[model samples]
Target: MYKNSIKILGAYGTKAKGFGTTSFMLNRHTVIDAGNLLDALAEDSLHIENIYLTHSHLDHISDIAYIIDNYFCKRSKTLNIIGLPQTIQALKEHFLNDIIWPDFSKIPLENSDVIAVKYSELYLNEEYHLDKQTTLTPVRTDHTVPSCGYIYKVNNAGVLITADTFSLENIINTVNNDMQIKSLVVECSFSSNMQTLAEVSKHLTPKLLFQALKKLKRDDITLYINHIKPSCLEEISTEIEAFRGNFKPIILKDGDFITF
Candidate 1:
């Protein structure tokens, strides 16, 4: 098995006093999303070289703004913000526009002519080599916007992170085809009682999550559950415990670490 560490910086669907929104770090240099990154990494946030975004949602991309602004003078190299073309477009037009935040992509860094931030567009189902041992591939996911999930491969082993997705067909297919996938990190945003809101928002409840897990062919893989809405945590936890499945799902929280 390929040995690589995935550190959970923030795993909740929404931010509360103790719970933070979704974000994770691959090894140390690469961050999966921007949510709560500044708070989680603190001064070590400067070490982040690349950020592979799962989508353009605020909860998933919120810390990108702060990272750039807070570390503006400290960073020497351009921070690579990567995601699907639509995700990058949304960030450019809506979030990082000059009206809301300074367009750091265009502005030069302090004491340097090079820009502080750069955006890289990734295509679905295509693998991009991060290094000799790491690669990232984007997969389509059902969400309110043009969103997608990420398959992060380290050496021969892989981990699937389904960021804020409702549909599971693509996720199941990805797992079924790739025997190297050792773990899955999926979102369950609400409890069974909020099925209507979950369906409307294109998120998953405990009931919906179990229904999707029935399609997964793997039985040995570690199943990690994330993105539980803070307000419904108790109900969602109870609902998840009530549902029986082949794999026991572990509710992920901030600072949780997974090695595969």
Candidate 2:
């Protein structure tokens, strides 16, 4: 692993027998999403204090309930769940509303006075310093649900994450304008043959993805691709190779490290 890198804990669009869903580990104490925390880190998941969510989707937020449930008695620090306003609301209303999963926000840890979970809302393009060395900024993205991508920086170097989106307009402009961002993690979720379904679901196919990247004015930025549907992996990989013109995008996998 590099000294400065975003570890790919889970790099698939959906779960399979072996593949994990979306998640990225920023540091020992922080992660970008909760999809595969328990599976990736096991008891070390107890060290996680923050989860910066991209959206309210199941594949992105599934492990939140399990992580809290697994470490409820062992955890002392509150698990801070941060995201956009609507993302927070959706987690509270539909997912963790006490009907499906226990609302850990209301429950205190056995060892500490702090609640098991906490929520923080994000505003787009505003930078929030998480610690002395790290700053994260949210950016808008086009998805079926209200979602936001993240630009995480450390030591003045940064990586942009476009979690799950169909549109690359904001992404291209962001990378072109933000010199701090040296790497971009984009999603390519479907094959070229499934263009209609990808469009309808607000995901990107290889054909659409490269076609959109044709508008990217910068060539210095490294492109990393993720969130590939397990079923379409082979087909999508082939299409990506065929269509990715001058952009050499490395397809990401579980446990990969993306250094900015």
Candidate 3:
């Protein structure tokens, strides 16, 4: 029913008891990450055409295993899993190697001509057109492992999502230069007390995030914060509240919808 669209399937900073990890559905057909794709989506909605993964982190790619298994019978064609070269390599060598999980790429589909999964290579800063209206570009991010954020632009609505990152320079530069960037979704995973851990893990805490924001040149951008560790949510919120900045980041939970 959505024409020019927006939707959020899962938005918890991290999974709580009954909740799931970080996966966000765009237009109900495209996935930002596969963290909790199966758990968060209904059977009908799980018939996604493309899954754009930010990185190969467990929490980022967790539900990829389940979706392929449960929906194998229903998938009409090869499910396109797109990411950077390193991300695709990691998935092949580590996650879907048949040792950890069954390689869906090797499995045959009911009616399709070939395999169930396809690993597509994407380079950092390269923009690919998904359709006439939608485009996605990956921007490199600083993480413990190889990671990249995504810029999804549909017509005039632009969403800049930093899946898991600590580096602000690259993101700042991109956001500052792109006039189409209207909304930003960033992560803050720890409190000020855990700033050291956040740094070591290449994540952002409220303190570090503030310091990172100093690199950006704009204040009019709408900021939506995600990836807050459940345990330290309160402390991180308090710290971010005291952050004296022009760009106020609004915390988002699971199932929140954003419209441009």
Please provide, for model 2 over 1-260, each residue's C-alpha lDDT reduced to its tens digit, 9 standing for 90 to 100. 55479899999999998899999999899999888998899889999999999999999999999999988999999999999999999999998899999988999999999989999998999999988888999999999999989999998899999999999999889999989899999999989888899989999999999889988888899999999999999999989899988889999999999987
- Spell out the clash pairs found in candidate 3: none
**Which candidate, 1 or 2, would have the higher TM-score against the true structure?**
2
lDDT of 1 by residue, 79-177 (tens): 899998999999999999998898889998895677988999989999888789988889999999988888888888988999998998999998998
lDDT of each residue in 9-54, candidate 3, tens digit only: 6665566776567887775568888777766676854578788998
Judge candidate 2 against the unseen true structure and give its global Cα lDDT, from 0 to 1. 0.92
For every candidate, C-alpha RMSD to the true structure in Å = 1.6, 0.9, 1.6
What 10-residue stretch in candidate 2 is worst by lDDT?
1-10
- Higher-scoring candidate on TM-score, 2 or 3: 2
Q: Which structure is stronger by lDDT: 2 or 3?
A: 2
Clashes by residue pair, model 2: none
Rank list by TM-score:
2, 1, 3
Which candidate gets the maximum lDDT versus the true structure?
2
Q: How close is candidate 1 to the true structure, as a TM-score?
A: 0.97
